[model samples]
Target: MTTRFFLTSAATTLLAAIACGPAHAAPDLEAAQAIVDEHSQIPTFEPPGEPFDAKACMADKKLFSVPTSSSIPFVDGIETSMEEVAEEIGFEFQQWKNQAQPTQWVQGMEFAINNGFDGIDLMAGIIPSSLGPQAAAAKAAGIQVFATHWADTTTPDDPAATHSFPIPYTRVGEIIGAWITVKTEGKANVLIIGSDDVPATTPYRKSVQATLDKLCDGGCSHTYVNVPVAEWATKIQTNVQGALIADPTINYIVPIYDSMSQFVLPALTITGKKGQVKIATFNGTPFVIDLVRQGEVEMDIGESLGWIARSTIDAEMRSLCGLDVPEDLYVPLLIFDKDNAETAGVPAGFNQGYGDEHVSGYRKLWGLE
Candidate 1:
């Protein structure tokens, strides 16, 4: 129950007034299209003289697979982007779902390997206790591994050996912290809802904490509320509801992902403080974007858009093709608020796949196309 508030009542009022102004306008399709077109115009980086033979890379008989247990919206995005990449590169693609269970993760890993995958694209936020061994066994089998979201380096072996590219989760935290500071007018009493299952959660939490400590005067004081990893939505709702009942003074709530934030939103509704508390979260799912547009969520750090999946696939392809691979690759973070949620659109693999142009730009970077 470590909660710290930086702004006094007067400061909070002033900040609120500033935020209430017409700070941002509605989404414009033309503007968004222009931005996307600009991004497309940017030249793709080509490896020096095509070091690996693309023909040989595509001829690998084994399957290219992505493994996950659910959680992030971008898992679907990853799969969609991978499918497109596979089509472009002429490789078979497979996907396995663990439904966010530790046991299921092991099962998925075993299943993928048994099914004859030559390479694997691992998602972020799986239970590391299971992941460490699964990754080790996969490596032992000489299967190439690529990772997104959580750094694959957290595996048992030397990180360099386990993952072809490690996405920087800390930088994402910094982006989130900056957005929160602005949205809350430099005064936020943040409650960090976390999961125990994912090893990446620890780093993600710490990075946000560190960023707040550095940016907000009096340091961003927060309470770390532990939520059940399996039933995160229920736990978050229960905890948030209880917290609001006890102290209706909470100014901000930040969850690790949108699915968990679903709980907090209902708690805010029950407390009759729907838009009063500044809600911030990770993973720009459609629900989160709607919350932002409706002025329910103040800001969200969008990790969706399939950047990790594409990166994982690219790394796997590179490794299998014997190309030089980077030790770590960072996926850029987008701060979504009422100003930009509409254009962000539905994530990939939804009823209509293909995320917004902004997300596609990051995807292109990962795929290097």
Candidate 2:
């Protein structure tokens, strides 16, 4: 119901051209490699020189993590991590997933403040809402507020944000874009399904365009469709099918968030364009990984759900305890394709999740091992 359009006449002129329009140019493997090599490395976090008492820090402390929609598999994974970490560290963990409407995000913060939580992790759900006042108010009340997956989104003036923010989302887009270039061998007509409601989509789209400019020089053309979170289920199907029909040359379909597979893939099947378009996405959900395993989808870039939970909790504790913690904790990003999905991507029999390196790693760093 909250699906909003980027343009008024989207139906008639859905293809709002970007600077790096999709061109079916010759494959530029060189460009793709250069990017891969340049951004291949991520930072690693180690314990501080002077240690603090984590057990003491979390003593009698309660933390609340709220996601916009816990029903979404990816969000659910993060929410699950919050709970698991809370149990390990001995703190109360809770979630407020009212899927609030309009300014409800601010309202929820007001509610949590009154509830007397020590710290709150505001997940990506309310990044675009009026959270500045709320964040400042929480800090004034001595409540540490940390946001994951949305820490550096459209909110330039982010509140008392943690430096422990990991997940380089911009880098993620570039990796996917580079993959498309190498896979298409240069000429990729890409249909990018994005959500403008989530401001983080802006940086990701820019990175994708930059990759297209480099590798898609062989005449790569692209069309971008902005679908808000509220309206994805009803609108993604119709809009994607329309885009595919509008331009049958589209060989690659990139969903900024792969969870769109829930709605987008069904649309592909309905329109009989299943094999016609390939899908590569961020957030390697188990469902999408299955698609990769079965050769239903093309590529998936995934981070460990358990690891992210650990890193997020690490950041929260550091903030609440006022320790000198590193900013931008590096979370590893793993890419999986059909060819390597079984052997190397996710490996066999491990489900779609990553190992618990961070889980144990954080334990040692906190001296809680």
Candidate 3:
């Protein structure tokens, strides 16, 4: 499947020219605005390939998944939707319950191998390389082992794993950076928060930095802080608060993951900088959308959780059925801001704003309709 890389080098060069100047140099507002406008519209579903008989291929197959953490609402929501899709395709899909621990991930792999499951998916943020021995053992036992929603679109697959359902993390980052540049009108002092443990975060920050460099033209300055996933609840607030206190000029806070907003909101409140510093982030998490609705968060780049589940299942099922797997998960991202945040629902609902085109789209592709 042909996937869209949101920001191209040609586009970047056309945006602005880097010049030696003090921070907050004039940015190319026209270019930044164009980037923001392009992503404002709702995205449509694109089939990864020609339709195939999914039911016939999945007749007796079973899939067992291990998520980074069952405690995370985002991970849980996707896992639940995945099971719903698996049932429609006549495959047994079970999640190996765990609390973001490598030991549990190993155990999940062992269970899948021992029980003769046809496929095992390491879902969302669980690094595959860390479980090399378990992955090798699963492969030896003829179990198809791969990661879903764990890597960026550009990341190389871990040799120990079979394949991946990569997401457009870098694209999401570029959108966030463009949003910041446009809103600040060429002057943006931003704080970027991310987790080092999550492999996808690497590309997310890289793309955001690159976009800022190109569009801001030395007009934007940013500070990056790494807070591991486990420490988000405790560390994010302190880190954000400290940064705000140290640099009162910051106008935006960009969290690579929307869930980090929970901690960020309190930091803004504690520092009395809620309105002073706007927020822009990725992930279409419901709570974050509500923040946008209430005008707390300035913008959020969202990928439908339901859409993600279907795309991931489609790829994994294709692999098990001896069909060609798409190069990347064909899921698309939508920009959510105050103007359209309420469309997701007054209080916001998981995967609610994005139309359900993918629901019917996948049904047709899999011959379920």
> Could you tell me every candidate's TM-score relative to the true structure?
0.74, 0.83, 0.92
lDDT of each: 0.60, 0.71, 0.88
- Tell me the deviation in Å of residue 301 in model 3: 0.5
User: What is candidate 2's lDDT per residue for 196-272, written digit by digit as tens?
Assistant: 77757878877787778767774677789998887777899899989888877889988888888778788788878
User: Whose lDDT is higher: candidate 2's or candidate 3's?
Assistant: 3
Best-to-worst ranking by TM-score: 3, 2, 1
Tell me how far the alpha carbon of residue 149 in candidate 1 is from the true structure, in angstroms, after superposition. Answer: 2.3
Error of 2 at 260 (Å): 0.6
lDDT for each residue of candidate 1 in 1-369, tens digit (9 for 90 to 100) = 999979899999889978875233322334323332332221333322233444456676455444455455545555666676666556677777556666776677787677777776666554333467777778788776555455434433335234535565665566666656655555667778887666567777787787666566543467778775677656778888888777676788878766576678888998887878877776656666777777878776665445444455555666676666666653445566665666655332221222445344433443434
* Total backbone collisions for each predicted model: 1, 15, 2
How far residue 131's Cα lies from its native spot in candidate 3, in Å, is: 0.3
Which runs of model 3 end up more than 4 angstroms from their true locations?
A: 1-25
Quickly count the clashes in candidate 2: 15
lDDT for 173 in candidate 1 is 63
